[model samples]
Target: MNDYVRGSAWRVPVTACQPRPLSAFLSRNAQRRPASAIRSLLPLEQEPGMISLLAGKPNPATFPIEEIAVKVRLPDDASSPVVVAVTGDRLQKALQYGPTAGTPALVDWLAQLTSSLHGRPLPAQSSDSTKPWQLAVGNGSQDLIVKAFEVILDSGDTALLQSPTYPGVLPALCVGQVNTVAVESDEAGIRADALERMLARWDVDEKTSSLARPKLLYMVPTASNPTGTSTSLDRKRALLRLARKYDFLLFEDDPYYHLSFEEATPSLFALDGQDSDHDQGRVLRFESLSKVMSAGLRIGFVAGPSVLVDAINKYTATSHLQVSGVSQCVAIAVLEQMGHRGFLQHAARTADFYRRRRDAFERIAHEILRAEPPVAEWTSPGGGMFLWLRLLLPLNANTAEGDSFALISTQARRAGVLAVPGVAFLASSGGTSTYVRVSFSLIGEEDTAEAFRRLRRVILDL
Candidate 1:
């Protein structure tokens, strides 16, 4: 009876549950793994009056660089620039090998930052009680995404993913031999009806009968890649209810959370933490500095239940050892210079920059693609860099259904325009699609009209 409460947000009973022990879900390889001897000793060095003779880290004094300075362009002018510097102790940390989890200062700063942003309680150091959550730094969110899969999946384990999802995740899923089930989506992102139906019939369905019931649901919720759609607050609550019903973990990969052109919706992580009785166990959220700050820095942080984070850290210990110390140090210096308020202000400016690009790109698309006897249709994105276009093309011999592959790879390329064919984002291979993904992120302002013009010509010819 403790597991059910009536008349909550779902119009269904809220399920009171605890996360399954992480050890029960870890892969065989992860279960057999050992901690890095050097990494284990890193904590002893922190004790007062203690000196480390252990790690083979090269002396920072041997490094040649004395200081590093970064020039940040002003959002409005670009004529005036501000300089942020890394020197003294910070510079020393940059040049040396650091802790596998991350540098202490950056880790603590991100912990507080995430807590404030997501409305969650800060994780405490003591382990006597059930610690609600923790954070881990990775080379990038992409790196963390792969590791998360490794931690949870065996060779044939199943995972539920949104349709037309981020293409980057496909290869990682393949590498882990994880089976992916696609959940349908609409303009507001993943549809709860489709997801609920899939889960309800999973065990009895012939297609999924042999496959293990999925324990994880991977989603990009805000400004989903390729689709350019965001999940609404009502939809998020519905999805979380399904997650509770199915007892599955939700991986919220939200790199574009801060890049919304309109007001942002509450994230699944934030929503899950809203319950006063539960801190968080069902949602693991990822954040990145790539889009907001610098992609080249390759700094990202993951926040979730401590049990899951501990497994990810164990994998990190043996794998990359740690993210590049120089990268983390550079990130920390820039973040400190910006401070919390300034960082948010910078995010708003970045969003405005993309909003301009989206406006110009959409105007051209409407003029060219939405003419008499329209050649294509698309959703105007509220945020992020992509425009997902469903092309109106004739059916070919290769596919009974209209597909964009030849039009994009062959015809569009010859016409001097590039776009990713939609089939690449599907859960399974060799499917036909009339959709294509066009990006406005790095495309030039002057070339927007011409690019769409060329694409229109190609479609008209087809």
Candidate 2:
């Protein structure tokens, strides 16, 4: 194996391995799935001067509403609100059943947005058989995540996941019965040395010898859900090298990408493009408008090699058919109104909002929990809505760490404060943790300090 200098932006040469065909990575069920009959006929509607009877799409003429107007609040000026109208042709397109891929205009808009944001150029239109990088919108980042798993994994396939990961994916992994291995993490997120040791000794190690090597690595690099830890740029580059060296695909679940309080690090998807030797197959980045825009809109997009995206779309064709057309239209309207620069400005403001909340919450936490002997310790999050706190409770006889499950689910709730027990985020079964995840996002500003006080009182009472 070749070694690359740490902290450098330089790319390491991957082992001389022939790229496998896209079909080889697909599950058995995906291989046999047929294209939707109605979706196939959608193209004929596009032909110029072609007036036709197609599938049972509703006529927009019969729809009730004349127009839909959205009042967008400008971050700079609260009094001066901009109203974006989605009416006439645009409204018609939204109301009717559309293609499985997503609304064309919205899709195009996001493709450009993603390309520009990530610094990866859109693949040129070509007749070549090999698929290049592209984007596909979904119901939300969660929807895309499930579909990405469906596209790649079969029953019993192993996946390497960061410990204390997002709980959302856990249910899906459970239902699929996929073998999940927990990779160790530090304050900077997944530790490179731990991951390297795991992979280096996978076949030989007694603990992993019985299991197959992981085909995928699922991670939330920015403001990781329960941990609220952001991986550094150097750490990201190191992980990308591991993915290439081990030949496993990376699922970059980065819904909080825009919520970073500090300068954003280049994403794995962006880094894949920077390398001259690589073809952007190593990372599938999932992004959502949920955090920045409206979660109810349920609009998210995944960008990566087209082969992987094509597979994801195949699953979407049967599952949701497409993201809600109305939602897509709404997203397009807002994005176009904001434009790229304005969209980024809004993101910065959103980040600032959370940063203030984090500061307020942490101040109270320090006053209440970090007193004499210090009942709790936590890393101040750089971004996202969560603050992960590890309590210094008495250690259990069976486990090295004290458990927070009872304290959170029972005591905290009884104290009129609620939080997710850190155990919920653990990737493996029977895991124990002394940590709890608290959200600073939804809590009222006035109640923020009191919530921590309540939590601290509960801990003290215990």
Candidate 3:
């Protein structure tokens, strides 16, 4: 035994000690590595105007910007249709070579907003010695989502996901050839008991045992897709504990965090800040302006420890170069204009819109379709744009013996309603689920009643 491992403290440490040099540790990561071509020029990008051999960034001149206008038609009683002009130097930036991490102004604005809204420590990036929080921009949160997966998930590596997860993640994971293990979820997002059970016996699960150990937990903490559920603060804490205990990353997919039905469900990031030794560095959070603003803009961001973010950004460098300069500039301009309070108000507006739709849908379903209430149960999402419905159809109904996929595809479509099937969201051969996902965001007010009526009929027939 070494002297460091001696006396009264002569007892062996209960926890395993595994440490490696930063370079050695990183070299082990095969998933994300900066491309050789890009790595060679890092120092050059910092060099003083040396008339460069560098990024093949598009010439700003090629971008056409004859005119850009946004017309708002809000309710008459509400604030007069606010229309802001976009021109001058602003228009030029929107049509030029922008920052790699995002427009500096936009990055700064977002950092401030995240710090204030989530109540996280604002790292000072100036004369003050505080560690500055870094930022990276991407084309919509979806772009960031794919990049995050690329950064850590090796082909065949295990990724823990919530049961009845976001259907969007399915295709991406399939393309990556990654193995996912579903953790049963309840009204409060992923269930701690179920996660503990799955993780505890991971090495023994026939389906998962052959794959590389799971290094990530993918979850949408607020208004989860296919199952509009938000995990409570206590649940969040338990999850953090589990992550720390098992040594894995927590991918907090929280695009809908701001849309919570409650005044505050409190973000994992926010709660992590409460403790001094809080290794919040484990949770990588994702957000987007798509749900809050317009999905067309394709602007999104992720927040995590500098090391992980750097790894993901390196992938971004070789893959997409950077999110569009125009988009970043526009986002910055709009975000700066909205500020913090205005942004919150706008978020509330978005939430209010969805909540109303949810109530209407639930009311119609209860009155017309659900013969027994608890027989077909679903969490009333506190926020976001989805309502995951778990129907009470026979597990082995018709020729099919699983999800509402066949019914929705044939009957519902024939009946003129389209909803995502639950099986589409699960791991292949995971299990049978009598669930279906519905989105209120895409539908209009006048069409809601008819859509529900169609959906109700399909369930009644089942």
Candidate 4:
């Protein structure tokens, strides 16, 4: 495909910035991958007055299931749950096989949502044609992320991500024989200045010179997984500048974009257009419906350059085939009823729900852990489900900063409190950290106090 694949226009930011060619980044596997023969023709079956024969698609009539109904409560109201149902042609679409990209109805809705939210043009709406950008739905964001890693990075290639990164992406790296490199992160996520210093001296840096230049820089960006640190607009602009200058795609794994304590946080995907010189497709964003809707539904979508999105869809064709048809149908129906505005309203409610939990968690921690000189320190999350606590445990000579592994694992477990060891999130660190990640999403308001009380007792004993 050409670097600047011109696309037919749509109603959204129909003429966004031209994207840079991904030729430099695509793995050898992606370059040689041919289109799936059967899945390639799946779209033709949808055209008017066509499709008598296709693959061994089972008859929906034979399936005993008749309907899929979902009950959902309103964002503001707690009184009643509204029942959303899928039937007729929609039901048929749900029962049978689906297009490789996604159920058309769901994909269209997501495309529209992405375009409107991101201020980017609608990608040319077809599989056969090419465009600078496109969208593909997946089983979940993690599913699409794995495929992206497979398609983009080959053996011995390097993947750069923030220290204390999401553990989910680590396992995926094994497939590509990739080298994991961690850049330090502060309270606002990955430090752009630190990255700038490293990249400026890439060849001279003995530790990095042997490895290939990083083709992708992955980040959670908003309410980061273990740190709960969110980058501001200025911070994001600085990072985008770095991505532009460094010539690496920004792989934004932003499941919590809609779950912010404040207004909807614009993703790197949404902000790329604001930088005039920044290439539009340099930011490939993976978004999940799991945080806002249902995790078991296993629904997520990727929105970015068409070449990359297509690469992932091709992988999906051979793997899971497509996201659950019923899940897509159910999502489409619920979203159709809610509309775009209603969806945001629901997201606001979800954010507020977590925010309350965070507040209660913070208050309890302050009372128990901060009673004396303070047993631990943490930044209260702006959004998302976590509280990252930096415990002030007794320090050893080897770990001047202190280590939470033993304290959080053995000691804390014995004290009846559990949190993810900070080392689990680091790629290179030798399991040394004074940090532990706790979730404020599930615990009740009443239980917050005792949870910290247990931790305080553990700290005092040690």
Q: What are the lDDT figures for the candidates, one per model?
A: 0.82, 0.82, 0.69, 0.80
How many backbone clashes can be found in candidate 2? 0
TM-score of each prediction: 0.93, 0.94, 0.84, 0.92
Candidate 2 on 1-462: residue-level lDDT in tens?
Answer: 344321211112334244455555676567777877777678788999998787887777899977788999766675799998899888888888887778888888888888887898866766323547878889999999998887787777778899888889988888887889898877887887888888888877898776656778999999888777888888889998888777678899999999998788898888988998864688999999999999999999998888778888878877778888888888899888888888888998899988998898888889888987678999998789988999888777967878999999998898898889989999987978899988989787568778878877887776
Worst 10 residues of 3 by lDDT: 2-11
Model 4 clashing residue pairs (backbone): none
Candidate 1 segments whose C-alpha is farther than 4 A from its true place = 1-19, 73-79, 128-130, 277-279, 397-400
Per-residue lDDT of model 3, residues 1-462, tens digit only: 211221111111122123211122121233335464854465466667777767666775676775455644233324666564567777776676555567767777888888887787666665311243455777877788787777666565667888778777777788877777778888777898878776676667886556555667889888787677788788888887777666567888888877777767777777766666645566778899888787888889877666666666677766676788766766666666666777778878878887888787777656655555333557677777777787677556432535687778899899998888777888555466677877877676557768777777777776
- Write one digit per residue (lDDT tens) for candidate 1, span 307-419: 78888888999888899988888788777766777788889989999999899888888987888778899999888999999999987787776899888999999999889
State the displacement of the C-alpha of residue 317, model 3, in Å, after optimal TM-score superposition.
1.3
- Predicted model with the maximum TM-score: 2
Error of 2 at 364 (Å): 0.7
Clashing pairs in 1: none
Candidates 1 and 4 compared by lDDT, better number: 1
Q: What 10-residue stretch in candidate 4 is worst by lDDT?
A: 5-14
